[model samples]
Target: MIADTELILNADGSIYHLNLKPEDLAHTIILVGDPERVPIVSKYFDTIEVRKGKREFITHTGMLRGKRLSVLSTGIGTDNIDIVLNEIDALINVDFTTKVLREDLRSVDIIRIGTSGSIQGNIPVGTLLASEFAVGFDTLMQFYVKSYTAAEQKLAEAVNRHFSNLSFSPYIGSANPALLKQFAMELPKGITMTAPGFYGPQGRSVRTHNMYPDLIQKANSFITKEGLYITNLEMETAGIYALSNMFGHRALSINAILASRLHEEFCANPAEVIDSAIQYVLNRI
Candidate 1:
């Protein structure tokens, strides 16, 4: 049994950060980065069952075409994902009343529908990019033991070799194949690089000077030994993939490209593009 300090709960017995109970969630979950986007996804539901929010976390559970699904917002970045994933796992796999794990574990499908900037020129703005693999620029997974797969290790080595001058090591993670085949078979597939932040981590500079001036160009040109290139840059997929894999959950990230770094083009109507992608995912999943 775990201590209360380890997994703090509210007075009503809801999870500390998410404020979600086991009954509030569904087996199929659509994760968004923006809290406001929660209702945007849930709007397509036939009947809304639950609507809950706390901090940047907002959850809406309902039925979509007769399938029970839950859409929850995780705000942004790997740090938030660290909290969301672990809490969701605990809600289903652990008995909060006794602070003990259940005899039988439950795994859920986590599909992240978020926006990203394309590093590759061919992938234009408004495009929907399905992450076949996610490369983490952050050190989230490094804190966990044996978090990467054999394929990921090989890809990580190649990525490190390409950006050898960088001080930190990057990790690679693959999306669940079953989920990918089910939801993203016809979509444009590529390796997504998840940055730690919106600015310098993604090679964006305002008043501050960038450590790697040619970071975006190098990332765009990076081709693995197997000839796979990095497609886009986002903030959450790698952590989602790694943590989901560790917890036995099926994870996939579907990105709506809002900007093209190589072409220097940004979507004129990003809302429409995101809505279209959300509708597309709803139709499939």
Candidate 2:
């Protein structure tokens, strides 16, 4: 049995951080990085039945296309992804009252519709790209025990070699094959690089300077032995993929390219681009 300290619950028995009970969750979930984006996606729902919020985690459960769905905000970064994914998994796969794992495991479909910046010059702003694979530059995977496939192993080795100048080794994670094929089969697909932060980790400069001045250039030039190149940079896809796979859930990230580091371009109408991506995902669901 899990300890109370380990599986902390609120007075009302909802998950500690998400403030969502098992009944409030839907099997199909959409994750956004901003809490405000939760309503943006839920707006298209035929009817909203549950609306819950705690800190940056906001959840909306409703029906769309005669199917039940829930959209939640995970705030930003892999750190937040770690918290949100683990808690939600526990909500589904564990018997909260008993504080034990359920006899039968359950799985959920998680789709991340978030914005990203293209590292490659060809992938321009405003394009909706699906992440087939994501390489995490963050340390979230260090604490988790993950077994990689031969393809993932090869990609990880290639990325490590290409970015040899970096202090730490990077980990590669991929979208669930079934989910990728269902929603993003026809979309442009690429490997996404998940950075830990927005400014220095993503090669952005404002008030502070980055240690690796050529981080973006290196990421742009990186290519795997199989000829896959890193296409875009974001903060959460890698963590989402890794944790979702670990928890026996399906996950996919659909990105709206809001900025281009290669061409130094930013999307003029980001709201339109995000709405388009949201509609694209909603229609498929």
Candidate 3:
């Protein structure tokens, strides 16, 4: 049984951060980074059932084409993902009222539909890409004991060697292959780099100076001995992949290219691009 201090609940007994209960979610879930995008995905539902919100977390449960699913927003970076993923896992696998682990574990399918910037010029703006692997530049995984597989270790080593000058090391996480096989048809598969922030971490310079000015270019050119290179840059996929894997859930990240770092281009119709990707995911699921 988890202590109250560890698994905090609201006055109504909902998860503290997500404000979700066991009955509020579905077996299959779709996660978006923006709260507004929650409705964008749920709008395709044939019948809507649950709609709840608190803070940046928003959840909508509904049926589409007779398939029941839940859409929830994680809101921006891995920091938020840390709260969302654990709470959702607790909702399903833990007996919240008793604060005890259930005999039977439940694994949910988590798909992140997000917009990203292509690190490689060839990926092109407005294109949809599925993450085969997610490289995390954030320190989220460091807080937990090691959970990386052998393949992830090799990838992390290669990334570390490539960027030896950096003070911190990056970790690598892979997407669920079953989910990837189901949805990756006609979608280009590439490794995604999940930055801690949209600014300096992603090599964007504003009022503050960038520690790695050539970060984007270096990331673009980095190729492992296995011949894998980064395809896109986003702020959430690595955390989603890592946490979902840790909690025994299947996860995938489908990206809509809104910007191109190599070409210095941004999508003219970003909303339409995201809408198209959402529809594509809806059709596949």
Clashes (N, CA, C under 3 Å) per candidate:
0, 0, 0
| TM accuracy, model 3 | 0.98
lDDT of 1 by residue, 75-133 (tens): 98999999999999998898989999999999999999999999998998999989999
Off by over 4 Å in 1: none
lDDT by residue for model 2 (133-241), tens? 9999999999999888788889988998889888998898899999999899889999999999999998888998789989999998888656799999999999999
- Candidate 3 residue lDDT tens string, 119-196: 887888989999999999999999988578999989999999999988998988899999999988789999999999
Q: Which regions of candidate 2 are displaced past 4 Å?
A: none
lDDT, candidates in the order shown = 0.93, 0.94, 0.92
Name the candidate that leads on lDDT: 2
Could you arrange the candidates by lDDT from highest to lowest? 2, 1, 3
- Native RMSD of candidate 3 (Å): 0.9
Candidate 3 whole-model C-alpha lDDT, 0 to 1: 0.92
User: How many angstroms is residue 207 displaced in model 1 relative to the true structure, after the best TM-score fit?
Assistant: 0.7
CA lDDT, candidate 1, residue 192: 97
Residue 234 of model 2 has an lDDT of 94
Q: Measured by TM-score, how close is model 1 to the native structure?
A: 0.98
